[model samples]
Target: MASLSEEEQQARETIRYLVAASRSVPGGALASAREDWRAQLAWWGSQGYHGVTLPPEWGGQGKSFLVQTMVVEALAEADANLALLYEVHNTLHLEAVWRYGDEAQRRRWLPDLLAGRRLGGFAVTEEEAGSDAESLATVAVPEGGGYRLSGVKRMITGAGWYDQYVVFARVPEAGITAFVVEADTPGVGFGSPEPMLGLDSTPVADITFEGAWIPEDHRLGELGQGYAIALDLLDGGRVGIAAQAVGILAACLGRSLAFAQQRRQFGRPIARYQGIQWMLAEMATDFAAARLLTYEAARRRPEGERQRPLYAMAKWFASRKAVQHALNAIQIHGGRGYLRKTGVEHLLRDSKVTELYEGTSEILRLVIASRLLNGYNWDSI
Candidate 1:
């Protein structure tokens, strides 16, 4: 990887400062739990980092994806929950609007979103559709100079809290279309947050739309272009997810190493044992590989090539590697790793979700195989 330019270095320092502030809040890990997390995110937005990647015309710093990735990685290393917030903004909201929204639409929403004056979310997943996004049942029908949206969106991160959301709904003849729905829209409502195995700090819930109405101008991109927008956005989002995994693995390895050097077993430090040494070696190897793949994907984007396979590979590999690293860290700590206060247990629990969300391991494998066997030639693949 190339050395960070001066601007990138400054952005990194800013993220580090934010991380320090985040950890200083009362309640530690519990500080960001539930509604409190929204407050925290709003506070970060107040600091003017919310639109760092948006173009200058839109009140953003106008930085490249690399800079955004660096900021996310730094935040993840400091606090994974904060990193998740950035993912919600950068991947789900910012990228979607930038890619799909028309000039007027961008001018209307980008400023507030980029300035952090408001929060945004992406609503796509449903009870019947997860990986198979094209099979989504949410429907949008043409109406009086606008569209009527009706459907249920499940497990949307920051759903109830965000001020705005980019929702996807199926159009019978035209296919899926993306719409900009305001939180206060007449027929938009959200359910209680669903309990999750991890990321409890980041709220997730189901959203229901009953006769929701939005102007046709709110549509993101042309009709029937929602799937393309989603795929491209996910490709970008995958890099962020991979970065989160790297941060988690790094944290696990650091904790495990410290424990190994201090804990005594068989009348000596466990770090002296060959078994412990081998486990550490494997963890280190995987962490390095995952990081490289992630950065490589980030780097490949500027070359005008689609990074679908690379991003999928990085996301899948890093997520799996993160889980294993966390589990190994647990083994190294024995009973201490099982304790919630030790933090290793939480890391392990949190690591598992990385593989399940975004794209599952199985889904990514199919994507990789398709890319390889067909050389990404859709006509043949």
Candidate 2:
């Protein structure tokens, strides 16, 4: 592994401090901060977390992509839900506007979003467009000087709560187009938050657009560019999710190590036993490997399309290991890990979502295989 630069080290320290501040609230250590998310979001924004990867001229920190991944990892250690929200906002929503939007659009939305006064969402997934994102059913019909979008986007993070959304819909002449729409648009409505398995703090819901009017200026890039934009945004988002997986795995490993050291069985510390020792060693190894892969993906993000398969590999391996590490942590804790209060069980649940989102484990495997079969050259490989 390469040595960390001063900028990366400083960024990690800043995120660590910010995460620690958000860890405590009115009621004990803010475990999930489910009810206090509003305050937490604002606090994180105030601390400059939302703009870590944005340009300095845009009132952002102008940090490197690698640094941003480190921040995401630290945030995930504090709360996976908040980490996901942060990743979506910065990597997907904000990046889309910065990379594709005109100056006027950037001036209109970037300030409030970076300051954390407003939140943004990326809406692309539909009821039937999970892995098959190209099969979008959303329609964008031209009307006068603008278009009226009509579609229902499902599993949107910050759906009802976000101030604006970067939506994707199909145009009659175009294949898939991206548009920015405010949440308060006349025809825009949100469904109740779904009862999800994990990410309780950042509940997702369906966003329905019933002829929601979108001005021409709100369109991102050229017509039919949504597919490319989604792929670009997802490449970055996958790296962030890999960082999140590393965070969760780190938490599980740390807890399990402590538990093994203290919990005595048959009059000796469990840590002394070879069985417990091997589990800890494996957890540590996975954590190291996952973190390295995530960092490598972030570092190679500037290479664009050529490095996409690396993102998929990092996300898949890290998330898969995260789930397994969570289970191992629980096993080490025995019956105590089964109890919800121990928090190990919660980590297990959170790890499951990492594999589901940002391209599932199965999908990512296909992506990596496709790249390899095509004779793509990766230095490390």
Candidate 3:
């Protein structure tokens, strides 16, 4: 990656400092425990880490998206689960509300959201609608001064934990509508938690609504715009995923390099051997390449021009690279890497989630291909 400006460099150092300062806090292992993750997010919010991209009045630092990306990457270097939590908060949840919600809604929701006093959830996925968000079965019907929402949202990241939920539901005449439903609403309920392979820190479950009623003011944007809003959020949000991928790769590379230099084999350090050196060299190069791609996407994304392909490209490449690097790092560590005690296994487990979330590797490829077919920003890629 090219050198950052003085301002950007300062942003990087600031986030790095915050991440380093939080080292003493029990985050990595703590993240695997469901109940403990709320405290983790609160601690980060106390550091002003969760408000990078939010407005000044919203308890955020009012930083640029690039700075938020830097913060996310730094958080990932220390704790992947924390990084994911931040991404979900800033990119996945708050960004949508801030960008699409009306002024009154922003004033009402942004405070607790940015302060970490209240967690927010994005309710879009359904049992039948994994990638096809339009196929969501959740529906909202006009009732009195509000709408009655009835449906189930599965695979919600903060299902049982969030204080508020931004739920997308089909309306009788308005098509898909995004509603801000309080988690404790009379008709709101949570299902049993789902078991996960990684990111166990962030609890996942289902949110079911049975005629959940919220004021008409709770709607996010104009009626029928929920799907479009969600799609737009995902387009730029993929950059967060890319940054996370780079972060995971950085951690894997650092751990692998340290082990190679310290672990002795064949009567000398393995770092001295050509085989080990080759693996380290490849990991370093790949990590750097992934970082470059991620930063490029972060830089170009907010311009709001024809940048979808770039975002998709960054996510596809970086996420795939992260998973591969984690596996390769494990390979270099041999049996030790396969074991949980080495911490390499954790990286491998966490890195796999990158490929599966935001946009799956396959979905990203399709996005890029579709944009390319339409000649959208063809020269840039």
| Best model number under lDDT | 2
Scored against the true structure, residue 225 in model 1 reaches a CA lDDT of: 90
Q: What is the lDDT of candidate 3?
A: 0.82
Give lDDT tens digits, candidate 2, residues 117-180: 8888899999999999999999999998999999899999988987888999999987899999
Backbone clashes (count) for model 1? 0
Q: lDDT for each of the candidates?
A: 0.80, 0.87, 0.82
TM-score of each: 0.91, 0.96, 0.95
Segments of candidate 1 deviating more than 4 angstroms: 1-14, 25-31, 303-305, 376-381
lDDT for 31 (candidate 2): 59
Pairs of residues at least 3 apart in sequence or in different chains that clash in candidate 1: none
- Could you tell me the TM-score of candidate 3? 0.95
User: Candidate 3: where is the Cα deviation over 4 Å?
Assistant: 25-32
Can you write out model 3's per-residue Cα lDDT over 14-96, one digit (the tens) per residue?
77777776665555343456556676677777878775777666778877788888877877877787787778887878887
Query: lDDT of candidate 2 vs native?
Result: 0.87
